[model samples]
Every structure is written in C-alpha cells, then in structure tokens.
Target chain A: MFGKGRFVGIISSIIAVVVAILVGMVFALISGGNIIDTFKAIYMGSFGTQMGLASTINNAVPLIFTGLAVALPFRAGLFNIGGAGQMYMGAIGAVLIGLYVNLPSVIEIPLAVALGALFGMMWGILPGYLKAKFGVHEVINTIMMNYISIYFVRYLVSNGPLNGVMGTARTVVIHKSAFFPILWNYPIKPVSISIVVAVILCAFYYWLLESTKIGFEIKAVGYNPKAAEYSGISVNKNIITAMALGGIAAGLAGACFTLGEMHFVSNDFPVEMAFTGIAVSLLGRNNPYGVIPAAFLFAALQASNLQLQLFAHVPKDVVNIIQGVVIMFVALDRLITYLLTRRKGGAKGIGNT
Target chain B: MEILNTTLLNQTIVAATPLILASLGGLYSERTGVVNIGLEGMMLAGAFFAVWGDYITGSPWVGVLFAVGIGMGLGLIHAVLTVTFKSDHIISGTAINIFSLGLTGYLLLVLFHTHGSTREPVTQLPYINFTALERIPVVGKFINEVFFNHTPIAYIALGLVILTWFLIYKTPLGLHMRAVGEYPEAADNMGINVNRIKYFGVIMSGALAGMAGAQLSIGVLTQFVQGMSSGRGFIALAAMIFGKWKPFGAMWASLLFGFGTALASNLQGTNVAIPNQFFLMVPFILTMVVLAGIVGKSIPPAADGKPYEKENK
Candidate 1:
C-alpha cells in the first residue's frame, strides 16, 4: 500500500477536499458571510478547543460504524444504502431489551448491542437473499427494506407499544445498566467507549478481510462472481455474509448512539448519516482503516454546524452542502484520474472510463 | 364504517397523480437504459422551485415551468456523470440526490428567511370541475367526483401515460431508445446514436419528475414542504417495476400505491386494529415479492444501469 500509487491517492484526496471546502466557502459568501471569520469560526468549533475536539470525536464514533457498514459491503461489490434501516433496527432492538430487561450493566449492555446487530442482520439478509436467489438488484431491494424498517420503527414508537410515559414520539430512557461506559475526556460531553469499540471492530475488519480465507472468498466473489463460483467459492454465501456483516456494523452504530449518547430511540435518528456513510466509504476507498480518518473529516465538519450558523450566518445545512459537494467530487475522482493519466499518456484502468 | 367509497377513490386519484407522473419518468429513463434513482431528489428540487417560481411570477403554471428547468438541469448532471464519465450509475444518482437535497435547503434559507417550509403563494393551479356532468343520472356525480375534479396535472399524467405508451411502443425514436437500453452495441452497429437517445430519455424523465413535484407543491398542498417528495421517487420506481416498465402498467401500479397512501393517512387513528404504517408498507412489500419472482419475473432492460461507450478504434 506504500508506493507511488498511495502517494497519488493522497494527493487526489487532498485536491478533492480542497475543492469541496472552496465550494463551501462559495456558499458562505452567497449567504452574506465574511469568509475569514467563517473559516475561523469553523476552526474554533471543530478543532481549536479541547472541548470541541472531544465533541468531534464523539460525533465520529457513529460515523465510523456507519462508514464501515457501507465500506464492508463495497468489499463484496454490494451497495448497501439500507444503513438507515439497519441503524433503526439496531436502535429498536437495543431499546426494546434495555427498556424491558433487568440485568447487571456488564451483561445488559453487550446483550442489547448484540440484539441490535441481530435485528440488522435479519434486515440485511432479505436483500442479500433476494439478490442471490432471484438475481434481483440489491439497490432497490435495500431501499425498500429501509422504508419497511423505518415505518415499523415509527409504528413501534408512536402509540403502538414503545411510547414513553408522556406518550410522546420517543421511548422512555433506557435503564442505566444499558448505558455504555463513558470515557472522561477534556470536559463538556464525555466520550463513550463506543469509539474504542469502533476502532477495535475496524481492526478486526482489517484482519477479517485481508488475512482470512473467508474474507478472500468474499472479495474474490466481489471481484468476479462468475469466476469465484467457478473456483468453488459460494458467491451466494459470501454475498449474504457481507451484507449481514454490514448490518451488524450499522446496528452497532445505532445501538452505540442510543446507549452512549441519546439514551432513547426517537423519530429523529439522523437518517442522513447513512448517506454520509456512502461518502465516507468512497473517501476511504472502501478500506476499513481509511474509514477512521474519513469519518473524522465529515464529523468534524458537522461539528462546525453551529459555528457556521452563529459566525458565518450560514445555515447549519451548509455543512451538508459542503459534504455533498465533497462526495460529488470524490465520486468523480475516477474521471479526474482518467484525465490525469491521459495527460501522461497511460492506458485506461480495468473498468472503462 | 365503510372504507371503500368514492371519496377514497377521489383521494386515490389525487394522490396517485404524482406517483403516475414520476413513475412514467422512471419508465422513460430505464427503458433507455439509465437507472434514475435520483427521481426523489429531482422531485424535491422541482417542488421547491415550483413554489419559488410561483412566488416570483405569481402563476402556478410558471412555477411548473421552473420545476421542469431545475429537474432537467439535474438530469443533465446525471447524464454527464453516468454516460460520459462512466461513473457508477448508483453512485452518481446518490451524489445528485445529496447535491439536490443541500441545494434546495440552501436556496430555501437564502430566498426565504426560515427553514423547513417555504412561503407559499396564494395562487395555485385550478381544478377542472366537471359540474356540468352532474345533471345526468346516478353515475354522473360519481364520475364528476372520481374522474374529473382533480387539477390539470392529473389529466396530464393520464395523457402522458398514453403518450409514453405510444411513443415507446409505436414511434421510431422510442425504438432507438429501447435498442440502446437492450443492446447498445447492436444499436450502434445499426447506426443508432445510442448516447443521444439515453440523454433524451434521462432528461425527459427529469422533466416528468419535475412536473410531479409541481403537482405536489402547487396542486396538492399549495406550498413546498422540505423533503416533501419523501420516498415517493423510490416508490415510483417500484411501481414501474410492478407495471413491468410499461407506461400503462406503471400508471395502474401508481394508482394502487397511491390508494395505499391514501388509506394509510385516512386510517391513522381509527380502531381498525391495524397500524397505518402497515398499509404504507404494502406497496414496498408487494414490490419485493414481485422482484423475488414469486408471481412473475420482473426483468429489466438488458443494459439498464450500465454505462455505454462507443468504440474508440
């Protein structure tokens, strides 16, 4: 991975990020913001202070899981846009157990998280199974699954069974035993151990995909399902496993967010993060290790949402605009690469541009 | 106590109008080989711009025109990315969605002082009331209520479905589009300009989807709500699949899903022992079953969603 190719990737990534920032600046200027002050405010909000930095790390924890959810599936050439649905299922499973069960924290927390992963795994298997059996496309199937899971969650929360004491849209707070252990940081919001879990899972993912036989078969199927099948690898099995693993990661994201931060599941579960995970996966090149920094970049940008509103007078939505622009350019990076190589007179890559 | 009534059917037609238009949009693009999941985003942009256009010109028709322009512009971006750059169709569609989501919100804040809902102009599109037919016997009132009382876009949706059917099955241009979607190399060998047809299909899809947005904003609700298209775009795609990608089949499927939506909202608080969300899930669940080939095989065009490139040799 350490070569001229890696250097080129780093350079292009910088270029993409820079262009995205410029686009954001343009939006700020359009919204009647002073350029330098907005830049300073964004800096001050995201990385300038210890408190802000802690908040950024906390924000990144969920993104790390969601990003891995998307990245994990891309390893098997599957597009898992169902992260939002998977996350909701995770939250539901965790909240259901956390709200109903009584146990020691050591037992309850992990149990709830595991249930969340199981729920997400069930959701993931639907699309994977459909795609493998009927040759139906996963993209549309995953999207349908998202709506189904989302509406089911809505039913459970709003007056179906899980409504809180006040009978509002949210559930009652989970038992304290279900809470993730909080890691004390530099004041403000305490960062949860979820970040450690996210990092550990990423490492585990690296080993699972790179050093394991099952991982090799999964990747081989993604590279070419026909070839993998001819070589005695079960393409269908790998596809379903890849999707289920993604579901587990997304479930962890939702469970962690609920247990460590929000403490209850609600309608406003940051569904957009699922789409942002796509951008992260692209930036990370679908590599688990790369997801860490990519998630941080997005989370830090989102951290400046309030500062952008207060100082720049730009709406908080502008950060999403910036991220959207970033994803667009990143998606177009292949075109940029093609142009770069054409300048140096190189051959086209494996896939035609 | 009765759930099935003319009022419900009337509501079904009204709700299905947007789905019909958007699914027809999906039909055109997919028939020409481009999978346009960005219909959701495109519709949102159209909804916002329709309100903005009405605010600017004080005319709902002009608002619709604005929506068409925005939708086509977004469609052009999708075409360039998927067709020329050979980017992943799904990825490019996702980018377009994200881009439109932000752009509409950004512009809404810039144009209107608030977030979420826009300032709706009082003037909306007129409904074509067929009160003259009420002078007839028993069926007259039923016909007027269910068939003729909707805004003009409803009729346009119907007209375009027929038009799309004729164009796709009858016209030479549509033949070229179908060939490009099914076998681009073969089409190219037969001297058809494959990319040109695909661009037209995609742009037309955007135009129709934009009109769908106009229907939502100016016709149905009389204002633009943030993310108002919701998952209708994706639902429209499912409807298209249920209809076997034919314009007429898609139209009927839209009406069925639209009926589901209408029933879901109407029965939200009723003691029917079933949650409204379950009704809402029916269309999606049915599409999944159909895709699984339980009832019938729902096959797409051969080259659908794959980028086409002319030989450089």
Candidate 2:
C-alpha cells in the first residue's frame, strides 16, 4: 500500500521515484550502456523467474526492517544515521546467543532476536539521551557510534575473545536452534519465515505511528517542540522513545540478516545496507505502508547487479546513484509543497534535525 | 627523543593539513547560515577528480584545479537545494554525500578503467624541503623538518587560517556574511543580498574542501584511493565545533585530531597492547565526546542551517 494520502502527495512521490529511475537510466545511456538490454536485464534479474521473485523477497526482508528503523525516526524528525552501528550490535547480540546458548529452537530463536533488539536499543538510546539532555547533535554522534561499533565488531570477529577459528574473521556458525524457519527452500539462499516477521512489523509500524497517542506526541514534538511542550508532550521523552524504537527495528534487520540469512556473524557485514535505509525511507515518504513497495523496488534493482553487468556492461554502482537521486528528489519536499499549495506561506526551515 | 618528537610533530601537521582546509571551508558556509555536512562528499569527488585530472594532464596542478571546480559544483548543488528549493539542510547534505560516493566510484571505473584504485600514480606536489639547512646543527635541522618541509598545501592551509581570520573578523564582507547567518531579516533590511552571500560562502567552502581532497590524493598519497577522504570531512566538522567556529580555533583543533590520527598510524603493527581498532577510533570517540561536552555551552550562528526565505509582503 502507498498509504492513504492527498492526491498531490501520492503523485509527487511517484514522480520522484520515476524521475530518479530516469536519471539513473540517463547515466547508463551516457556510459555507453544499451538501454533496451539494461532494462531487460533488470526486469529478468529481479522478477522474471520463481527463483528471482523469491530472491527479491529474501533480499527485501532485511531492508523492510531497516526501512522501518529510518522511517520511524524520520517521522519524529530525527535522522538516526547510527542504524549501521545498531544493526551491528543486534547481529553481535544474536550471534553471541546463537553460539554460546544451548536451548530449544523456539525459546532460543525469540531470545536471540529480543536480545539483539535490546542491544541495538541500548546503542541507539545513548545518542538520543545525549541529544535530549545536552544540545548535542545526533547525526555526528550516531556516525561516531557507527565507526566505533564497526571497529568493535572487527575486533570481536578477527582477534578478540569471540573470534572463531584463527584468521577466519567470523564468529562460529550459529546454532540451528536460532535459525529462521524456511518458508521456501531455495538452493542459494533460502526464503525464511523472517519475511513474515518483516511484514507483521511493517503492519505494526503503521498502526503505532498512524493510530497511537505515543506517535501523536512524537509527531507533535517533531512538528514544533515548544508548541508540543505546551501541549503537555515531553520533547525529551519522545526523542528517546522514537530513537529506541528505531533501534529495535534496525536491530531486527541485523537479526534477520544474521540468523535468517548468513547463519553466522562476520566482520565484513554490508553496513552500506543501513545507509540504503535512508534512501528507502525518503522514497517511501517515511511511511510504513509505502516502505514495503519502496524496499521491494530497491531490492529488485540491487538484484539486477549481476545481469546488468553481464549483458549491458553497466556497473551496478548505478543503483547507488539511483538511490541518491531518489533522496535528492525527495529532498525537494519544500519545493513540491510550495508548488502544490499554490505558494501559500512560502517555505520555512522547519527544523535542523 | 627530540628527533622522535620532531617526526611526530611533522606527521601531525601533514596529517592535519586536509582537516584544516576542510574545516575552514565549513567555516565559510556556516558563517552564512548553511549547514554543510556534505563536505565529506565534496572532498571525495575532489579526490577522485584530482587523480583523474593529473592522470590525464601529467600535472598535479591541473588535478587540484579540477578538484576545486568539481567541489564548487557540488557546493552549488547544495546551495540550490537549500537556498532555492528550500530543502532541509541536513537532508540535502546527506544526498550530496551519497550522490558523490556513487558518482566517484562509478567515474573511477569509467575514466580510469580500474576498480577501487589507480595503478598510475600522479605527480605529487613538490615538498618544500630546506635541504641546505640540514647541514647546520639541531636548530636548523628542527626548523627545516618541523616547519618548512611540507607539501605546498600544508603551507596554504596555514596561510588560509590567518587569511580566514582576517577576512571573517576584519572585513566588511565577513561582517555581512555573519549578519546573514545571524539574522537574515536584519541583513536584508540593511540591503545585503542574503542568498547571493550564502551562495558565495557555500561555493567557497566547496572549493576549499575540494582542494583539501586534492591534498589527500595529490599532496599526500600521490594516487587516488577509494573512500580516501574517509571521514576527514566529518572530523573537520568536529574541528569546526571544537574550534568554536573560529578559523584559528579550528586549525588548532584540527592539529589536535590530526596528532591523534598520526599516533594511531604510527602505532599500527607495534607491540603496543591496544587493539588497532581502538586506536583508530580515538578521533571519532573524541568527536562525540567533544560534541556532547561543547554543544550546550558553545553556540552556533543563530540562524545557522535555516534557509533564508524573503518575506512576501
């Protein structure tokens, strides 16, 4: 679902996505790529076959989780750039249990996931606390936390106490007890029940943000802090809550990647995926409903990396540019609002966050 | 021991040169009320283009010029988005960063026909060595090694610090820039062109940042490396804050962080008990600590990051 919204809002969002894709295509054309072949390759790579569709879902599963992580804070008008660190913490938490704990499948599975979220929540809460208490900006703080967490993980997997075999740069294989149940037994990477988890979380996200009072307070705080304070909302409290909740979502993303897909933790996890969540959130207009399709599109485009390179001779990095373009288009929210609103009250700075 | 300190100090200034340049660039944009987190991206694009330009032209000067132009281009985009489209400053900066990352990586493949890095090293900027002074005793040797022996950009960085201080504090234009940042309405009432000044500040930042990136590729490394800027731009941001947004303050802060980086690099592979990762994290951790400590007490420009919208009567 694209969310129930004003017609202009829906049109603008769609136009943004289209314009971004077209921009990517233009780049491809300029780089001597055959547009017809590139299009065919992209189509066939992500959606052409049963395996392709399954792969898209499998890949989109983690993104859906991370998309929620970014979009939730974005709703509260905070940019949680620390998703990479939060995800790393989550994966580490899940892996530590998956290797060290010996328990029944059901109990250990949920326990690992919960602890993963808890770890991520802790990591996220620190910056949120600092921003709320002090005037400390979260973007730089979160970025610092990401480097620290990434390096911390590097230490754990490479030479620290949690390192598996010598020079392997990975933790030991996670126990079967923590494995996500297979929904489809694909040969390369199985489609897990985590897809179901991802969907349910998206649904829950929609309900939490759209229908709940907590979400109302967060939005109010985001819309105007001083005004929100007058309306009996504690800005500090909402800031912490939003970041903590976003942490939980990002943590789940890591759990899905680790336990459901990789089945073991490694030092070289794709932290760029966390950055992609920003693109996904912006493209989704920071809505849970829109995030599903937005995540699917990004996952599909990413899956085309191989085919595009093989047939069209286009580097898959074009996808990254495409995502960046989407963000650029989305960043024109004020201009779009200005045009749509018939120039009422001109654009304001809104807020720094 | 004196020799060792001299070596460390030399390394510190060399290492800090890029940060010094980038933070000064940030000083300009911020002084005009635009928050530029995209310094990282602008620097990155500059680094890629620097190598590309030199590889094509057989001259590092051309590469430095290309970097300046590209950096300014990106800065222009930032200005357009924040000033013209009235987009949120941070979001636009984030977009610039991502866009620059992909563009650089992609262009690296297309132009260089190489992945990740270039095989051909470009000509490096000449190091200003006082070879004759090396003949003298300790004081001459110290003077030669400590202050004089560096790439030209390092000297330029130092020069710019003094220049920026004079420009920002002494010049009428600098007062106008600060006025625009502090209160656009007042500046506009005084007949200052707020948007034009902001564009100039932001574009100037891009040029300086781009030059900083060139320093990384051509001045320091002599070859372009993927992700070479590697958070230096953000480190510069931290320096800007730590320096209280003053040019001299930021230069000192940059040197402090650069010293930490030099120590980390120097300590690598040593028998020191600390993990290399922890050593690598010192500057970042320090940045966070600095932000947490300084933010409440240290104030930014009142209207910094707020897009100036002309009042419609």
Off by over 4 Å in 1: A3-7, A185-188, A343-353, B119-121, B294-296
lDDT of 2 at A328: 83
Give per-model TM-scores.
Answer: 0.96, 0.97
Clashing pairs in 2: none
Error of 2 at A136 (Å): 1.0
Fold similarity of candidate 1's chain A to the true chain A, as a TM-score: 0.94
Candidate 1 residue pairs that clash: none
The CAPRI category of model 1 is medium
Candidate 2 C-alpha error for residue B140, in Å:
2.2
DockQ of all predictions against the true structure, Cα-based: 0.53, 0.68
lDDT score of residue A221 within candidate 1: 79
RMSD of each predicted structure: 2.2, 1.9
Model 1, A1-353: lDDT tens digits are 57654555555566778898898888889899988988887888889977668878888988888899988878888888899999899999899889999899999998999998898888888898888888777878888888898888888888679978555778999999999888875556889899998999899998999999978987887788889999899989998999998999998888888898889998778888887888788777777988899999988888878888888798777777777677667667666776665553232221210
